[model samples]
Target chain A: MEIELNDSKHTRNSWMERFETYLPEVVYGSIDGIVTTFAVVAGAAGAELQINIILILGMANLFADGLSMSIGSYLSNKSERDNYQKHLHIEEWEIENMPDDERKEIEMIYRQKGFEGKELEMVVNRITSNKKVWLDTMMKDELGLSEQKKSPLKAGLSTLVAFITAGAIPLAAYILAYAGKYQIDPFILSSLVTVFAFILIGYIKTYVTQIGLLRSILETLLLGAAAAMAAYFLGDYLEKLLV
Target chain B: MEIELNDSKHTRNSWMERFETYLPEVVYGSIDGIVTTFAVVAGAAGAELQINIILILGMANLFADGLSMSIGSYLSNKSERDNYQKHLHIEEWEIENMPDDERKEIEMIYRQKGFEGKELEMVVNRITSNKKVWLDTMMKDELGLSEQKKSPLKAGLSTLVAFITAGAIPLAAYILAYAGKYQIDPFILSSLVTVFAFILIGYIKTYVTQIGLLRSILETLLLGAAAAMAAYFLGDYLEKLLV
Candidate 1:
């Protein structure tokens, strides 16, 4: 797709624009959802488990694990933000209390960046003269932190929604088969459904990251297939061991 | 742990120092490894698959999926690095061919940071006077990209090693049980092993990121448990549906 860099002013902000920052959470959640859920369905099929058992386990996993992932994402993001803020405050205080030392730090940072002599002094003076600029520079250069003000709640919600949405694909086949919609083995149907889901997620990932389209799609598809294959074979072997 | 910022001079470069950048890849690989492998085992058990099948599927997932994930990580990182380099080269060309425009961009960037009047002009001139500085400023300020010079091969290797290490935990019980060492249900043994592994990984994650230890450990454990529970129940449901 054509991504116009300066289109923000010309075009109305779409949903993707509004929630662009949360795209990572969504992609991470969806990939996890598809891989884990499909592994469950594939393993059960390999073991020849009863249909009710598969549905029970799948549905339980879908919501429970999805929620768990979202909460984890939220907590991780919150903690990171808190850590950044804590450091930012510390930097601000240091700049206030030790202006000379902070100025030296700015000099050191610029010097390391290859500045020297009159130029380095000018750069340092220009930056330290402004409190905000000095603080931001210290936060970034010294502490290696970014101003990622992502909302934890929004991240959690995005993860949950994406997790459940992508996760339901594998189980959909079974649900349909149970409803007598298809004659084929539910495992086969689930594979087809999941492959499609993988490709769709891959495309979305490409859109968000603006990476290579074919490679991203293939990478995701291969990842899902690899997971399912491994689960299936392992389940089959375990069945033989018990017997 | 006490992390001394200037300790790089006092301390000799350690293995960790050499490979610190690959920590994220390791964490990502480990988490994916444990969750996916355990899901396979849990689903197979719920389906009433034999111990042999669980081992087979779990091992397959451990190796196959782990490798897949590592390769994916490698390729993605490589592509990202390439993209950054491509942009860096373009920025260099722009700075050389169209110096005026590039200098203005530098001014605009600093201006957005609230610099104005003499300070803004000085900042712009200071940066543009040096080719290297100008390019670096344009890359970071205008493009919002940082120099992430992480080796893709090291990232892949770290991911593969961590994946196998963490992924092996869930399968340990089945391997022991198959050897007739344990009389308890392998699932129960596996759960205990995995919970410990989860906590350990959580602690590692906490160490790497310097987040809350208790919260991180609890989060990882809960995530693993939730995924297992879901896979178990889904397998159970599917079995019944088929019958």
Candidate 2:
């Protein structure tokens, strides 16, 4: 049992931790990428545009939206870490410059946590004896912050990779139609593959959400279909009206 | 200080808690709503469709997407709460049916927390003495779950309201042009107002993210513009290709 536990721990430390950290970004990018790119394809198809036009519009939307999303992700993550670091520095400065006040604040916090008299003093002494532990306690108990930092660049890269990978699925048929000798109706083929992409995304989401497979797939499919339908009908109506 | 604290506490109990609880849903709905509805408007305008067509398409996309988002939010929230509750019930059953094993588990948990011998036994006894507290401790410490439950219906309603309110901003100018004797081009007016809407969302986001006002606004504007530009250019290219 001990050996098995250690083996699992070793595996988790190596790869599982990284996977868990960036799973949210991957899910976000994948869903957004597939939905928006397919919406472009649907709209072009509804306007009775050629397969080449669908490929052009779909690819453009995929890369542009992916880049925009990644940049947004990078900026937000960087700013959040900066804010946390700023607070951390302020706390460290307070600890060094005004040790007496910092000690009092620690006592006050533990007192509120139900320790009192000698017990409170002992707890405070135990924590404040080590500068690192003191700083960590203040950061968590007083400011309610955690030090689980992540890299902004890696976050952005994960988003871009996930977006491009999932977003490209919708355009597979259109690209094939433009490139290969296969005579399948590109729009129909695109719709079919897009459905498969939605299912894949939905299955991945189940890992985080703990929802039933059928329910997640149903919700994703319905949402994607609605977006595509709206775009398609709008395009068709506009084409009839003006073209 | 006493009076100020009491007054603030009173205010928080009445409304602040609710605001904090549903703020995430509001932000989600508001951002998605504005970005998507404006994309529809941009696409229609790029196709040189009339104001009525733009209005029709924009409104349709707004309501349809809003409904889909709210429904998605509702199901996910409901499923998460359900999963938590299921685990809670299982924990309760184990405590009732196998108290010795549960007690041993509690001791193991506290012992791992640095308590030893008598101290560990005391801590475990203190926790498992009260059924509710014991259950809560097991839920939090053992299973790493929190009982911060939320009503799924209220969450869905909040999402729907935010989506409609924020999403309607981009269509405001178009609606005015259709009803009033306005001389301004509706598309230009829409572009202007949508920028304002983006700024508003960005400003609200700063309250949660603690990022600088300028940076948040710039990020939101860039993302919105990118989506709108992609939609518009795609529509324009398709129109030229087919028409």
lDDT of each: 0.75, 0.73
- Per-residue CA lDDT of candidate 1, range B93-132, in tens? 9988999998888887777666788867867777787787
Chain B TM-score of every predicted model: 0.91, 0.88
**Cα lDDT tens digits for candidate 2, A1-243:** 010111222345647878877887897678777877777777666667667545555655566567666866787788778778888889899999999999988887655544567656766776677677678656655665555357899999999999889989888887788777579988898899999889988888887677789988987888789878876886677557645
Model 2 regions lying over 4 Å from their true place: A1-13, A39-68, A75-149, A174-187, A226-243, B1-11, B39-68, B86-121, B135-144, B171-187, B226-243
Clashing pairs in 2: none
Residue B73 C-alpha lDDT in model 1: 73
Which has the greatest lDDT? 1
Give, for candidate 1 chain A, the lowest lDDT window spanning 10 residues: A1-10
What does candidate 1's lDDT look like per residue over A73-107, in tens digits? 77777878878877887888888898888899888
lDDT of 2 at B165: 94
Fnat by candidate, in order: 0.28, 0.15
Highest TM-score among the candidates is held by which one? 1
